[model samples]
Target: MSQVRVQPTADAIRAGARAIRRRNVEIVNAAGLGHIGGDLSAADILATLYLGVLNVDPDQPDDPERDRYIQSKGHASGVLYTTLAAAGFIPDSLLDTYMADGSPLNGHPDRNKVPGVETNTGPLGHGLPVAVGTAIAAKLDASPRRTYVLCGDGELQEGSNWEAIMAAGHRGLDNLVAIIDRNGLQQGARTEATNALDPLDAKFAAFGWAVRTVDGHDIDELLATFRAAPFERGRPSCVIAHTRKGRGVSFIEDRVEWHHKVPSAEQTAQAIEELSE
Candidate 1:
């Protein structure tokens, strides 16, 4: 059965976001490879979900009735791993082994190796389709579980996501909630410079989704938006979380080059200090 969604205080959510950012820096510094930009941008969203929105038990991650969360922007797996550790799914010590040889914590999350991870995802545009399938299954089983997927705005250029979007809206999978990390910047440059997803809200609305836009980093807004999923009676829900790339770190914030760039010792120190504040 679906657990009740916890409405967290702003202070609590901000604290969680800080912890995730601090740990994310540490993880990337230790691993020497990560999608740091996206990781930072998506940290708050991940924090809000694991800390308050998702109905998941670390000890019972595979429970059939538990709410499902899929990270569509899997390149930013560091954020996901850090959030899982924060939520007690695994020891914080495991974070030290991230991206190391023989470590289960690879660049992309592996469901078989990581507790609380719903699936293995790294390629763009894959998570939403899988989430749609799972949502459909839950509906067929008459389960109370809700499916949540987090995708990057740049990844929306993929055809697969649109196909899944069409299918989800057509099938009226109200149990599904898709959150887009609309950080604007992709790996190379602004998403609009590469492949424009302008009128993103209208695009999804036309697909028969109940669309809503929110400050992705705002904990209070995230909690409220997620708590009110399936915004319409018979259509799927889509949340366009407007976020800044490399959020919370002054040097990296909104810089496209920082996408997978590793921070130097000085940069890492500064990032830690800023997030700690």
Candidate 2:
């Protein structure tokens, strides 16, 4: 496999975004099922992080000094797997096996089977604690590694995340960054309707994290936010990325039905067409 050059140009990020969006549509279309809305919502953030910000090597996935990324909203495994493939952590051909009877790439992420995945995460609110542990380990070893965890806004309702958030701040883990994919919608309905987590920025601030809000789909803003480290001394960072579930495809955007709906052949074709352009 050939490696793409390591350069953080705007064009590269946009290309990665397009590739991930295209790959997500292909995987779901081929498997006949997936969390398409969540996958689409988090595509750009994953692309920017993996291609530009993350200090990972496809050739040496388990390198100790490498940065770590944990996907707490693991239902969007399609997005992560495709991003891994694009980053050369997995072969592009393996993507053909997604969601097959016995494929390693299941509907949710499994760290044991995947090379670059830092932890197995499917249950909401799990990755934050794991990420905190990883950061703590880095601090203990005096390692200069950074840890990032991307989670859904609805997942915030899980008490485990709050616990982890408190610990991250209490420990003064400035090497850690938690990104929330605040698409406003969850599995069934809007997060506001299911369990309101508004005033999310203030909540994080009160918890002791330096918080920032940005349009998640904007490549420039995403890159800038990731580059700007810990908003304050002796505090971890939190970026609340306001995103639209099913961002690229018009039919699926902001529609709760697309949360976990499998696109039919026609819908798939339309999605591919829209994303390609």
Candidate 2, after superposition: displacement of residue 40 in Å? 0.3
Pairs that collide, model 2:
none
> What would the per-residue lDDT of candidate 2 be over residues 1-277, giving only the tens digit for each residue?
2334466797888988988898889889999879999999999999999999888889988888888999999989999999999998999999999999989999888878989988999989899999999999999999989999999999999999999999998999999999999999998899999999989999998989999999999999999999887677789999999999999999999999998898888988899899989
Report each candidate's C-alpha RMSD, comma-separated, in the order given.
1.4, 2.0
Off by over 4 Å in 2: 1-5
Cα TM-score per model: 0.97, 0.97
lDDT of 1 by residue, 1-277 (tens): 3445456687898898899999999989988999999999999999999898888888778888899999999999999999999998999999999999999999999999999999999999999999999999999999989999999999999999999999999999999999999999998889999999989999999999999999999998998999998799889999999999999999999999999899988899999999987
Relative to the true structure, how large is the alpha-carbon lDDT of every model?
0.94, 0.92
Clashing pairs in 1: none
